[model samples]
Target: MLSGWEFIPFLTDYLGGDIHAPQEQFWFLNNFSDLVTSSFQNVCGGDVLNGRSLGILLIITLFVGWLFVKNDATNLLIYVLGVTLALCSTTFIDWTSLSHNELIMNTIGNIQFPFRLVPYAGLFLSVIASFVICNIIDGITSNNYKQILVIISFVLISVCGYFGTVQPALDRITQNVSEKYLKKTESKQTIPDDVVIDKYNYNAIFDYLTQTGETDYYSEKAYNNATSIINNIVYVNGKESKLIAEYKPNKIIYMIHAQKGDKIDLPVIAYKLTSVSDNGKKVKFNQSKRGTVEILARTNVNRIEVSYKPIVLYYVMMFIALLSWFGVIFYQVKNVKNRLIY
Candidate 1:
């Protein structure tokens, strides 16, 4: 990504302040109880609290405290990491407050949202929870209380999860399906049937539009444009022209019916690494006012191809990542086998 500095936005810095954490989400003594009570809010998308779920979470949290008393090396490390990451996820200084400090606004502001670190915090907490459960089960033969506690923990987790996250999420899905797909509304009818309803289509990030003097990337025109459509219609000299676009995941081929010397504006973004070939010969392209690629028809070209060619370093890093994954899996499997044999 660093190699293709011209194509990728926000490589060196990001100045998007609107995406930062809000004042309401800041951690404070008065709202500290929300750490447990807001479990339902995280899942179901509302601030509504479930008393039973809150009680279950609070019990689990107190159970986590027992790990500190036990003082196992691995458990202690996991506990410290989890607590530190959780605190990092909270907004110590609100977005508005951070705007005053230029140093913080430039450094920490690049993260976009501090809450994005919450997943890492949750991952460590989950590992600790699993360790605690396994330890309790292993000690159950010596102490009957361990067995009782294990049973209670399982029961409470299941019940609370069903009411707090599972059931509410299911309800939300049903509501969305009915409102979005099932219900026949005038607004929904205007949407084209060919438009692909995928995660990429709804990408909220508009760092690409930053070059176009657009500050609020969330605006409708900034993200959604003619290029976003599956069947991208070509425009020649600001007029609609007959063209057939064959779209693929990484490449696009446009068969345009244009004369020589016609300036063609293709419905695709002009990235530095984007290679354009007219007929069989490679041709240079320029960025139009709207940041779309503009190609000049040196000859009456029927076929034009566009594809991304990433730097060699990207492939090298990808290969290293695959090797690392294999190495980790092999070590883990070997360790498990050794334990079993012993």
Candidate 2:
């Protein structure tokens, strides 16, 4: 039940007891191969919108609790937990998803992070839409047929939605990797990433990697040996002309590689370096191992944007609940007055 907060920071890093972890960079660089190699590549390979789903569930439960349970911490905890769930949700959205598609899929590039979780909110909206339709049906029709129809609408729409958007994304990830290698014109000429390594001092090797963000210009084996401390790492863009690290003892390198002609609003992860390489270029450092702490972000444009679908959806649900409660109060008042002797 309480296994989610493994990556949460030590609270001092954040402004309001909230820490920041860039998502797009964290997953792709740290665990891209997991998705690329997985048989069920989509859901089984990486992450799906569990946080969004939980957040939606959390909000719906809280609102329903208002109708059923007394106002108390027990119910309030559910609301708080929903908010927490969304925060965790951002970490895994761009992962492989057999449930979502044939390969892996990521969110749109141009949108902000706060809006990144829109699909989840849209989903929450659909859920709310179904609920609204159900209640309207019950109040106006009161027939068994109406209830059955409402049930169908709820299931058909929600399931179709998540699966439809997700499945295609998986297909793209699977294809992109294969199609890319197939078209490589410099098949023999291109620099190989793996080669024999010479035994040398490990510190010098680490220093070389620290400066250039790589061990060798034409060898993945060298790069892998140096970054053995990390669990996994993958190239964000296909390849680059020897990536170099600007500087740092500990820093997160945020980079995005979008499709050709695709729209993107890459977030400003760094203020020091103004312009970076785009899709045709290599701007972000690829991490071989997952960091002790990780930030999850969408690989978009120049502004930092994290998806907040759960939060927004909860707010909408809460607002509806407040209005409903007010209506209930007014109805009670009118009944009391009509019964009083005049």
Candidate 3:
């Protein structure tokens, strides 16, 4: 119910396509959106709250206290006010030296807009308003009349909330879904290979790389250099230079039948953690000008293995996390068994 009233202004703004920053004239609590926008100064004009909505909110907030003075609603009102004030405190603080206070600035900056506190304020006001109305209804002389009044009040509140909040949200969702579907149908062109997809699409890939410690050597310069080298590579006896063995996520063995003093370039990015072995003997690997891993294959050497070794710390941390989860599960199981037996 509180959310419904709090979001009504936002819903109206969204519907009207007037969701931009408030104008200079509408800044400074003169409008609802201005009241919600972060920052003390309203240099960028955007949406502002409606005057009628503000008036209604103010009247309810002021008048509800009078109704709740004789009841326990006062305590709840105070608690609500305290919480709301705490959430809003950053808005009034001097942020001119925010650069010096990185932690404080980051915490507040995460909020995106200070005006978000307005919904919270509206929420608390709604709570107080509900309490006031209920308290007034409780004071009726007849029990039957009081019950009827309560039921009527609940129905009215529910109806108002549904229409004011849920309906607008549902309408917006339907509209967005329809528009997106239309766009999908209209789009026919293929995405270019060079075009980067949204980061969220590849977040899992990044997470996997991080977990395996494979992201340490991810340098853009190295990748670009490797691509250039691969493009200009000349192969001798290409049929003999083939992958001999493959292991997903870590190791690859290649048979490079290169003559004496022949440099065989492997199809892998050059990294410090990569270990190269020639014909079962450890060999020093060099990087191509393009940054791809390459090795000098001796005349007798027939096979080469390129293995990626992750840092030991990655395994240690994984083991520790696993152990902690196991310990927690054991403790919970033991407690549950004890309770059941007792």
Candidate 4:
């Protein structure tokens, strides 16, 4: 969560608040069938589950109820959690109407997808389903009835796996192959020399500091007219300076020569988590209307580094998580050693 655009506060607000509505949709009765089998379909689409999938879910629900009756506490808890997750994930609420409420929209609407929690629900339900099948098989004393139950379970599982997972994955792979290779080769589209690629085309929310417009390159006029501290150009002593930029995941390094009073403009956008250093020493930086970073050289600056560094609290939490994971692994290893010795 501390990585990438998640660390940017304004970007988070723009994504969770401004653009969450289009992702919202209501769940239907057939959605439960889709949820149980992990059926892939657009939430906003009018697609309905087939009768066979629906029937499978109905049988699974019946088994869940039976497990509850038999006082199978573990499976019952798992089933309830699955249902709760399904209900909360854009399923029950009329978010289309609730989208007007700022608090509600920011909090619950942050999910951005109706099916965000559906996969977890499906996982829990799958565990319960397997447990229920085992229980049913164990309870059957007659060999003939046990064999029939086993065959039925196997058939149902195979059908569900094929339709829910394998077929959808195959279809996606075929579509991607056709679109990426076949379609491009067939069309033979050539790029125009005048056409400049917009790196921030897909990243609209990151431009909150700029608020240039819906489009990145098209909104340059707005940022250009604004009184931003930085410009799109690098300067040394009031003269434009050329620099080489090395991009990385967490940081960007610039190889530029600068004397005192030189204002260097970095290509990277300015965010709350962004930090700038001149020759490994922290430097004060200003944000442009276009969200670019500008720094005045105090000394002869050779190498400048701009990085996205999360706060101390993020590192503390990460340390705790790693420690906890190691503890669990050590305990499990000890238990395995003891079992082997016995």
Candidate 5:
């Protein structure tokens, strides 16, 4: 959101309450009202001109206007004009009061703030300004001195623009990394194989798992109880029975070496779509308190499989999307061939 005076850097410090410093209730009330009021304010106050970045904007506007008048370049003119109008309407219009005009208000409300339009204004102005520069160069007589001067000016402007935008972005990234990651404290506790101790502290573990294409299941209760279930085997009374398993998003395979009535608690979050089977026969599964799938081992049962069957509608939609993409590719190829031949 904007505060109607965002263009003035000093006003931003006063308008948006500082994130680090403690503030009074009145400070919050004043700034909060400014945010909401700017979204619906129609008239620009006397201070508005002083707060606007109008110098560069004026130069771009003059170039675009010259193109519009000299060549009557309708395509470029219409685009620039449309973006200009959008920028003005967003900044100055009383959008919240236009409830009667549902379509316009709804569309503008989705954007949330008028200041976001400034980027598009800059982009369109840059494109039209480039065209105007090219036109000026074309109109000049074949003078080496004039041509070289124009080229040098363009290069300097480009270099200045690049450093002005990119250096600040790079500095901000360095500052954030130093504050969040470099200053974090180290931990010494040994985490269990089945447990993710502190998710925020072990974010890199989740990131690695995701990158390696493993399902990173997150259930507050389910993951916490996974360690307890495996440690204490309640149903089976046999020798040291160990269970080996392979996990998948929709399927799981387990090799259990346990006696009849022995149960193995899987480390996956239990869902209604999940089904369990043992040695080709379907078996009933119970969800533990932590929401993990619990399977009881039967006599001579060595292999167990748990699968999640996707719905029919999912496959149907995927098929339709695939066909639509193929149709689009075919159409584009045909159009390109036709254009080349003609």
Candidate 6:
């Protein structure tokens, strides 16, 4: 992407030696695009909470006992606030119940969480300091139920740290490149007669998402998802059926249109239909002998891509958020010059 900066020169030459043309067309991005890219990055950027690996919980427990075991109102207040924020920012909880048996995971997936809308989820990073003041418990202090809970809480933190910060940035970068270079294009207006419009059947795709799953999703409200799609197939002369399917499809369908005066052989139908995946191939049957033929209105296809990614960067980001927390603490101490509660 950095090398693509040279394209500006080529564009400038093409635009009649106007040097600024290259900068405008190829190199320089609009202010709005830059702003959006910077501001709304948390949902699409690096993971912020993968710090679960840092063992901050271990150090925190030790420090709390050393500094505030005797009694410190400031410490207690900070600890309580940090605990509340950590729980709010992380963890998986039932936002609501769906159907009779399903519990919806709503906490982490929620967009309304603080710092969830910016780079690395942009927390003030004060949660740790808050805990430092109230560092009353941890595996080091009490390894019973409290220890387990603390570890579990960190797990949630890791999840939020990963998704809100790192994952979103990766997604955004990939999408940016694709949009910049490999933009999606609508096919020609007129689909070939032999072309099967199987993808045109969108309703069927949604049906599969709802009915085909043996395991219910995090939310029973999956069909109405923003990323979800609806498929519908209006088969000509009732030759095919309509299906409302999920955005992600698992079934393959095709609209077959046999040419006039062709022998509609069974083997040919199977052979020809198989090739639909690679090209716009059609199976032609004998139109005259009660032979069936039709143009397919595709409504659905299997999910060809995914929005989530692996955990490599998520791990790195965990480090950054963790360190960032300390940075925030030092900044506060240096600036405020007072050891008081938030």
Best by lDDT: 1
The residue ranges of model 4 lying beyond 4 angstroms of the native Cα positions read 1-75, 90-93, 100-103, 119-245, 255-259, 267-273, 279-282, 286-292, 298-302, 311-313, 330-342
lDDT value for candidate 2? 0.35
Judging by lDDT, tell me the better candidate of 3 and 5.
5
State model 5's lDDT: 0.49
lDDT of 2 by residue, 1-342 (tens): 122232222221223422232222222221322222231232311344222233233334424533433345553444345333333234334433322542222343212233244344334434443444555667765555555576578679768755744654455445545332322121122322222222322122222223222222212323334343221232333232222222222322334443443333222122212233433343432222321111222345422122111224344556666777788899977864664423
RMSD (Cα, Å) of model 4: 9.7
Model 5 C-alpha lDDT per residue in residues 197-220, reported as the tens digit of each score: 233444333222222112223344
TM-score of each: 0.58, 0.25, 0.34, 0.50, 0.36, 0.21
What are the per-residue Cα lDDT tens digits for candidate 1 across 17-119? 1222222222222122454556434454443432212233323643464544366887777767766665565543355566567787666654555555556
Report the alpha-carbon TM-score of model 1 versus the true structure.
0.58
Pairs that clash in candidate 1: none
RMSD of 1: 8.6
Which model is ahead, 1 or 4, in terms of lDDT? 1
Give candidate 6's total backbone clashes: 49
CA deviation > 4 Å runs, candidate 5: 1-217, 226-242, 247-250
Model 1: lDDT to the true structure:
0.55
TM-score, candidate 3, is: 0.34
**Model 6 Cα lDDT, one tens digit per residue, 58-151:** 2243234335423656645544544334333332222222212222223223232332322222232234433543343442554455554665
Candidate 2: regions farther than 4 A off: 1-112, 117-127, 174-177, 180-342
Better of 2 and 3 by TM-score: 3
lDDT of 1 at 324: 75
What overall lDDT goes with each candidate model?
0.55, 0.35, 0.47, 0.52, 0.49, 0.32
**lDDT of candidate 1 at residue 236, scale 0 to 100:** 87
- Model 4 earns a TM-score of 0.50
For model 4, which pairs clash?
none
Model 6 worst lDDT run, 10 consecutive residues: 20-29
Candidate 4 clash figure, as a count: 0
